[model samples]
Target chain A: MKKLINAVEDVVVDSLRGVAAAHPDSLKVDLDHRIVLRASGPVDGKVGLVSGGGSGHEPLHSGYVGRGMLDAACCGEVFTSPVPDQITEATKAVDGGAGVLHIVKNYTGDVMNFDMAAEMASMEAGTRVESVVIADDVAVQDSLYTAGRRGVGLTVLAEKILGAAAEEKRDLDALLALAQRINEGGRSFGVALTSCTVPAAGKPTFDLSDNEMELGVGIHGEPGRETTTLGTAADVASQIVEPILADRDFTASPVIAMLNGMGGTPLIEQYLVWGEIAKILAGKGVTVARTLVGNHITSLEMAGCSLTLLSADDDLLTLWDAPVETPGLRWGC
Target chain B: MKKLINAVEDVVVDSLRGVAAAHPDSLKVDLDHRIVLRASGPVDGKVGLVSGGGSGHEPLHSGYVGRGMLDAACCGEVFTSPVPDQITEATKAVDGGAGVLHIVKNYTGDVMNFDMAAEMASMEAGTRVESVVIADDVAVQDSLYTAGRRGVGLTVLAEKILGAAAEEKRDLDALLALAQRINEGGRSFGVALTSCTVPAAGKPTFDLSDNEMELGVGIHGEPGRETTTLGTAADVASQIVEPILADRDFTASPVIAMLNGMGGTPLIEQYLVWGEIAKILAGKGVTVARTLVGNHITSLEMAGCSLTLLSADDDLLTLWDAPVETPGLRWGC
Candidate 1:
């Protein structure tokens, strides 16, 4: 590894310093806790949102902090969920009088730790802590053997929408309900084009031949639900969309569509995939009121893409229109 | 190349669908424009903030949209700048009665396209467009080569702070001024432990030996200033921090610091890196008021880290403390 730094151990610290230095206006790095927070406290009378997982998923928990999204984000090592202690500290830091909502993705470790932290926080100070576990990926047809649907790209969408609801002074229960609705309505299925190596793991997450691809992989480099031969963009779209459409009954409703890159795929390719999805949705009489194409959530340098569809309702549309301020997802006032 | 998808061509569109499906409340995919936006009209009288760049750097332009950040974000292909047409459309869409500010990272393609789009928008409507190019990475040392110090990690911070300022209803010129101040005060340097493969390129961005790393790599996997033997956490910090400290006269001043991951490095190692950086900064009499760790900005699965430092003043601190509502960054109310 030909690198530029003086040492490997100092990488995270140096990088943290860089983040602090770069955005002095919006964030303060609590070096002691390795926590990133908005310089001031969160809004009043609204549930404060805090989320985090591994470090590799940038602009995620941290980037999603601000006026309408997360209040603080605790980042762990790359591809590794933050420790319970870190999550505990973040829950404390972000909680105001209104309470704190943890948006935890449904990875095993993440779920375990965040669940423990929520319990601990509640016990610690009678501080109200609520958590919503996002399991939006529809890739896993057999949720029996696996932990469940791996929370992939939908976490980003959940955080933003719920962040807006919280910003709108929705109560903790309301925010929680809205988050669950968004999570339930959303489904994701990802396909990798190439393998990504985790630094600590120091190996490719998985292997695939040039002419083959794995379907329904998790974000942490986990193997897909199955493997398949190479195909055209339209055919691949059919495989991914068919599952999501069938699983969620999106064929009869309006949906918010997304074609997300798995870190390495280019946008030109994403647009092409979008075209295929659009045709499929139109053929099925599924109305796509909105669509987003590009890499929103990623798995390191994995060369692949995922499809997410959200069944949208008028209420959800209103909240989506609400203004927010964070790093990753924002829109309407 | 082992991938998760059935085909390479469907990556982007599939991923976008996943994103849209997950968060129907906050973001609606403008399929025609391939832009992500808040599902409603712009806020009245607030300056419309728009930004974009290559797609690989997540939680970037897209994640930073919301209340305290960008009004809209345009995403390009992986590692490739979004076309001018996209920027033009985003600018038009986000423009509320106020002018628009384009927060562009300092890349040749990004600069050219954003500039062109601004010009094009000017030709179409009276939407006043101002652009601020962020060039905070200090590794390159000289702008004479390689498009100057490539805007690496500082973009995330710049966008959040500037987004907050925009939310504060600052004029476009004031927002521009604040953006410059943030950029001027910030400096960064990165080291890559391993090379990441661009999906379309279908190969490692650069080659590295088992025991070496490339220093000062850009987010797009651009070659860095030098290649060095891998060292410890402290050693890497010294290399990255020394240059940043030398580049600016942050001598004994209070500083905001960041230790950012380049996707692949784990946080356990990142913390060890932070430990070393803290000691060095203390030795240098640099008052480190805040620090951030983990991957805020990344370059796919490149294993490495970046260091950033910003000299902080009361005004910058105030802006950093302001409320924001984007999906990526959040804070004060």
Candidate 2:
């Protein structure tokens, strides 16, 4: 594969080394265990937040490890879930007097691993841990790597919102309830203009013709719902938004809309798509209170975009507007 | 070309509409003039900073407009310089009681256009405008789009540093001197793994074989020094760094280094490449005090990375650490 990696097996660790080097003062890396932790240890009475999955969706878990975000991120191999031991270690490392919150995407491997780690942490360290799954992707009922709806873009929002609550000294149960409420409120759908190659596979995970696209693709380049001819940005926005609006009732409050790029697209194209999406949302009478447009959570070099709409009240909005000092998403600090 | 655009001609304006839609509160768009201005207009007496080039290199001009950064950005068409009228409009619009600073990249068209605009503003609006041209690309003595050197990654650093200086109410002469210093202290080099396709061009800008890559490539897919076989990230790091070191001595002070991605390269690969660059810089006794790794200034969907080293003093460091609330580079606010 034409990637900037040293070797197939060393991609995750090498990138982590770079992450550590770039933000040495703000982050500390456990090279042997493959966990990224905040440089300053966890607070005494604050609930510790931890979230991770595969390595390729960058700025996701690892880039979010800082103040107003996660305390630790357990990174696995590219597109592979972290093992139980890594998660268990991160659970114990971020644990303070307050409990730990495990924010997981709705992949089968991720769900199982985080569950096992939670069990292990409770049994071995005597730390109370609560696990929450994010299943916002409305792409399919099940995909190659996931059971239920795949957790795609909502995980990023979940981390930020829940991390703020954790920083406010919310207990584990309160955080768990907030996580579930967010899980029910937000929904995401993705499209792929081109497929991406995994380091181990060395070839595109799926194939698409020059004029075709994969609607509702997973974050790992798995098979999307349909492969169809590509359309204009306006038409593409309708395809993504109609399904999301049909799936949920977002009229209760203004929405926090995220137009996320699936790696290989440019900010220009992302903005073009977001412009059309905003027009469509306005036509549907949905006020976009806040909007984010970029590659915050991305598949590895896949050219596409995803849309996530989170129904929010003042509380959720306030938490989202709180100071976050992470690598990927930072503001108000 | 497989792109998510409605029509090739509408790319720039359509995307600006998206930018306006995404950041309505912090940004105000002049659709007729294609200028992005701060929603909260120019400060009463701050030296307004305005910088922009072609449209493809995003988060470069538009994303840098905000408090403690730029007061305005004049976006040109993709890979093309903005006209003099747009620049004159932006110059007058962002001019408070104080003067204005025009940070132009050293491309021929950009220099000529901004110069004409500065002259026009002086004659028509009686606004004192000082221009600083950044020519920091270390790749070639001359390139396809530029006369002496292509201003690439260093423009981002110049905007940020100069913007911070302007925020402190520096006069036009002081900001111009600081701009010259930053322009002298910074140097950049880039490489392209594959050519980028301009939407209007309907094809890749250049051709490269699977095993070949363009070393010292320009930001706009202009021919670099050579097209050689692709190497490991570490080897590639040496190719970019050795020339920069030979050209200038960076051992005098710790430098702020930016490992920037050309749109298509994922963050994982960017970090992997940055990791190798860090090792080489350390070996050369060049201390890296601060590092930024992401697609700050990108060329559409080009697959590549560029490095910028800006020699910094404590004042520049403090300004760099100051609060910036723009969409692209937001921190410490």
Candidate 3:
């Protein structure tokens, strides 16, 4: 298949350099090291935040490195976690006097790599490192094998809220706590209209006929919770959100809603899906106080969307409102 | 043809409601009038930045509302510009005494509607409104019916940089000028491996065979400038970046590069593409200051990627370093 890359092997590093070149203002490229960070050094009084996993979920790690979000983001090979060395370097880059917090999605490699980096960072004197492993996707009922639900969508929300808290000059403890709150409260579920091809795999991750879709696919394009006949946008949204609402009791509180594109779905359709999702949530008396529609977090070019709902309280709300300046998920005053 | 929406007509409104419910702390939805804003009132002296366009480019407008970026985002229907009423509403919602600046992508409908809204806001007392249109896509060589090149990717970078400028208390004219500079200095090009389905259209925007791709597509699933045999990611990136480099003389200046996913392209592949792009740029002697990889602007289910390069000066870099808080992009002090 034709692509815009050189040898498939050099794709990841070359892309990281390109990103650093493009956003010199907000990001830096460690060509020798594969780390992206806010151009400025870490803030003096605030704890530094770092997060990354696979290379393809663009704007997730790298795009999200800036003022209100990640201090640095490491890109691994596509769908692969950065090695501990990369994460360790990122920790060093963002480590101000304050500690660093790693927001890791619950994927086997991602968890392990980030965990290793955190441990490495902790070994340094005065370097307080902590992690919030986000497993927001409800796709996998069996948490063990599939990294306990495969932290699909909530990573963006968690970064924004936590970035805000960090911007507020909160201590590492408070920042970590808030990150956990956002992650714990948010539940995400996604479906795939088609399977995506991993370059190494060189084919569709799974097969979906014209009239079928895989519900609850992993970010790396793994099989979803179930495969069913293709349904309408509303039906798909319901399938993704129902489980999330059920798990989080979204009906009882106002929620932050995200109808994210699975790389291939257009924003035109994301809004269409969001419209239907609103009706479902309204019917359940779930007050959707805030909503985001479009591809915030994506699964390569999978033709689908995921729904993420973060139940909120005042603190979470305040943190969500905190100001941030990352390439992804920035907001608040 | 199945979609996640209730009725195609109600898509925008319903989606807005869902957004409101989802982030009550960070975003408040004006259901009666579809406008999203930071839940809090306009900051006392900070510039109120407002941007909006068709709904297909998620996290572009709405996902960007917050302290460091946009104060409000008015969302229109899929691939269609928001109406003037919506823009006016968003203006009022975000019009702090500091005035409002509309960050518009260079699309026919978006420019017209935002222009109208700016005029409307002028009529409304105590509101100062200005706009800057971003025409950064270099894919369309022709400057005819489609209003020159469609504003495909640079929207996110412009918003974040200009948003930071606004946050820094730059006067309206300065902010608008900065916004213009970002637009002028940035250029992008793309290639599509597969066409995405527009939910309302209920079919692929275009068709591609198993081994082919369309080059230079717009974010709303619009056709690219040409159709060619699919090529390697490096070749694609070379084509995408060559025009950009040639157009702006990028080899002479520091650049901020982006390898954006057109939804369906996997990150693994994007990295491959990025890696290739970096080599090409490096060979050209272009000093890449920073970079971003992933899906920032996307077309629905389109399996492709775009490359964006923004030539930066010291001022733009400063703004990039400035703190920002938005749902889509965030960063530091």
Every model's DockQ: 0.13, 0.87, 0.34
Off by over 4 Å in 2: none
How good is the docking of model 3, as DockQ? 0.34
Higher lDDT: candidate 1 or 3? Answer: 3
Name the best candidate (by DockQ): 2
lDDT per residue for candidate 3 within A1-333, as digits (tens), equals 444556677767766755655566667778777888788878887888988888767767777787767788888887888899989888877878888888888888888889888788777545778899888878785454354567878998888888778877899888777777787788888888766666667777678777888888777777766789876676776787677777768776778777777766655566667767777888888887667766677766667888889998877776666666554554442
Over 4 Å off, model 3: A1-4, A9-188, A220-225, A244-261, A267-298, A307-333, B23-51, B65-74, B82-133, B141-144, B147-184, B218-225, B251-253, B256-258, B290-294
Local error of candidate 2 at residue B155 (angstroms): 0.7
Per-residue lDDT of candidate 1, residues A1-333 (tens digit): 233334444444455665565456777777666678888766667788888888665556666677667788887766778888888888877777789999988888888898898888888867799899888878773353238777888887787778778877788888888887888899988887677766556678778887877778777767777878867776778887887877868865677777777765544455566667777888888898766665567675567788888888987766665676554554442
Q: After superposition, how far is residue B230 of candidate 1 from its true place, in Å?
A: 2.9
Q: Write the per-residue lDDT of candidate 2 for residues A27-86, one digit (tens) a residue.
A: 999988899999998889999999999999988889999999999999999899999999
Across all candidates, what is each one's fraction of true contacts kept? 0.12, 0.79, 0.58
Q: What is the interface RMSD of each candidate, in Å?
A: 7.3, 0.7, 4.1
CA displacement after TM-score superposition, residue B191 of candidate 2 (Å): 0.6
| TM-score on alpha carbons, each prediction | 0.64, 0.99, 0.73
Could you give the candidate ranking by TM-score, starting with the highest? 2, 3, 1
What is the lDDT for B78 in model 2? 94
